[model samples]
Target: MRLRALLTTAALLAASACGATPDAPAKTTLTWWDHYDSGAADQAVTALIARYQGAHPDVEVKRTAIPPAEFRAKLDQAAASGAFPDVVAVDSPDLPRLVAQNAVADLTDRFQGWAVGEALLEPVRESARHGGRFYGVPLRSETLALVYDREVLAGAAPPRTWDDLRATAKALTRDGRAGLCFAGLPEEDLTSTFLAFLWQAGGDLDTVDDEAGVEALAFVDELVNVDRSVPAAALGWDNAQVAREFAAGRCAMMVNGPRVVQVLNQAGMNWSVTALPSGAGGSASPLGGETWVIGKGSRHADAAWELLKSLAENRDNITEFGAGLGALPNRGDTVQDLAWQWDPNVAAFAAQMPEARPRNGYGTKYPQVSEAVWTMVQQVLKGDREPEEAAAEARAKIEPLLRER
Candidate 1:
């Protein structure tokens, strides 16, 4: 028996010496979820993952592209089950609600004094925080602008002021084409587009009952009712529909974002973008975009943070993602890339970034306030309520929501 035991020990030692060893540590697999379903965006994300994996062969990133409409519900379910993804891309405005649910990790200390974080655009940087702490990083951002067909303008300059807008729109309103188009559906579409006008008029969600608010609403009333420059059928149009109408030559000008550039280019139309006509308050645009967050329950938080940090810090990665999606990069440095500077369509949106304001300061009650604003907009656009009455009603509902926040 002693001889057999000696032989066994010798065999084990020999095997170890010959390179036989315990299995290597399992490769770190980080799961990522995002709601970018378009082909260009999907391709960009896939390429980003490929590059990341190439640099870190020991790490694997598993990505799932969720549909936008179903993404929120899926996140809620994952949060409840404690099976959250390692990294998630959420709409910037929804960050407050996720923070309230403790669904995302707090990166305040991790991002403290980080150079990349310090370089984010003001509104983008602000949107990534909740209660004065950072919870995410702004990946890309977009804002509204007035897109007009150059051919339709017929040597006329784009509108620069409210009076110019009315006159230009009226002049362009002949034939079957509407002079101006905007999404006015009784949904977030209307709220997002109308907020630009509201802000331009020196009003906001909290000041809807003020004179500025009435001025904004009444201006739209004039366009739709008095000037007949904007058709009533616009009430049912969404941003995509507005873009489609413009592409089809049914609209001379439209209020839209950079994403419409792809549509216009694909349609082979001659288009140019300009800042929205300035009102009493000057030009103001609403900020919109996605933020990258680490899930609260992620077991691989460190790895996730590394990936997130890389994404924000790497210029190529950031610019590629932004340009691929036709959105503006949130990083001030990246925004100066030749890709954006050379492209007039994107440059127009980038120029507006300085004055862009996020619809996020209202905290978790923002959705409720948006609901009230949209309701008021629908009422005014339908001519069911005068601008003054709609403003009063909206203010009453919005004030309570803001107070609750």
Candidate 2:
């Protein structure tokens, strides 16, 4: 037996929250599955596991970490074989799909009543919702921002709007260094970057073919094609590669997340983070995060919930955990915590959270929708079609998918 001895209070709460039986599970070992097992973040997870085990002598936690690429397939296999873990961490966007399939226990009422829920960031909370019910608790959250070299800028101020950003990129381009760089991979990497511009132009994912979207696409196209400020090779680059380029001084500025701080620091680079320049509308960026969910049919459902509550509600735990995990804290209390306010690397992210929104509006079958976005970006960057033409083609591709999903 790994987990045992639920109090009457917790048992009642669990029953109400997830319909978990009050009766004790015959097996006591509860498995926690996630998709991180390397570096500082994984070390934090290990420490968290140790702390939980020490506090509750009877409940033994078995932690399993898999690569992100293999996570979905492995989880699917477990679901089919009825061998799901007690607790699992999944990306926020996947929450809807998991809930729709009834693969995870619902935690709506329990979560809203949880102590930590009060200060939860609105965008973070929204990421955990699906069909009007909450199915997960935010384990980590992140958003994109402008990362730049203070020295490289040579006393120039960071740009605040699209026009200024374009001018800055052009002016900073010199001496073998590109002025700005970003991931242009034909996937979610590209979709997120473009979505920021799309929303900043007062366009939504559903309206990708609208005039605003075309303007956003055209702006990026100009940066790459006419301005020649962004590297052409960006077309084949992903987020990691773009960050690397920035840290190496191949680019003076990058659109990246807080995690880039670690890489830049390790490489002995001086960099500062700021919110990305807005379009005509105002500040807008995409949010990304992982959420903690209880697997359906797990015998240790109550125990899993208990563990989740302990980690999520504790300010010290989540703040430290997010630091190691390359995740920014998702609650106002944590974001406003003195440590975060003093930390330059993450403060920009904290400030940007209120304006950040979930990518593609949290709709089901988002991969297809994002594919249309990817096509639009790639076609424009490759110079094979104008921004308007690409957006129109993308709209044609997505109209049927919108209906199907």
List TM-scores for all candidates, in order: 0.92, 0.89
Give the per-residue lDDT digits (tens) of candidate 2, residues 1-405. 224445766777877898665567554688999988688768888888888788888789999999877887787787777677889988776666666556888888787657687678888888877777787888788999998999988778899999999999999999779999999989778888998888999887666889898999999999999999998999989888998999888999999887676788888888888898988878899998788889888888889888888888655676456567777867877776665542467777778987689742446667678878898899999989998889989888777666643
Leading candidate by TM-score = 1
Candidate 2: stretches off by over 4 Å: 1-27, 80-82, 403-405
lDDT of each: 0.86, 0.82
Worst 10 residues of 1 by lDDT: 335-344
lDDT for each residue of candidate 1 in 81-127, tens digit (9 for 90 to 100): 77888999988777888888778899999988799999888888988
Q: Using alpha carbons, what is the TM-score of model 2?
A: 0.89
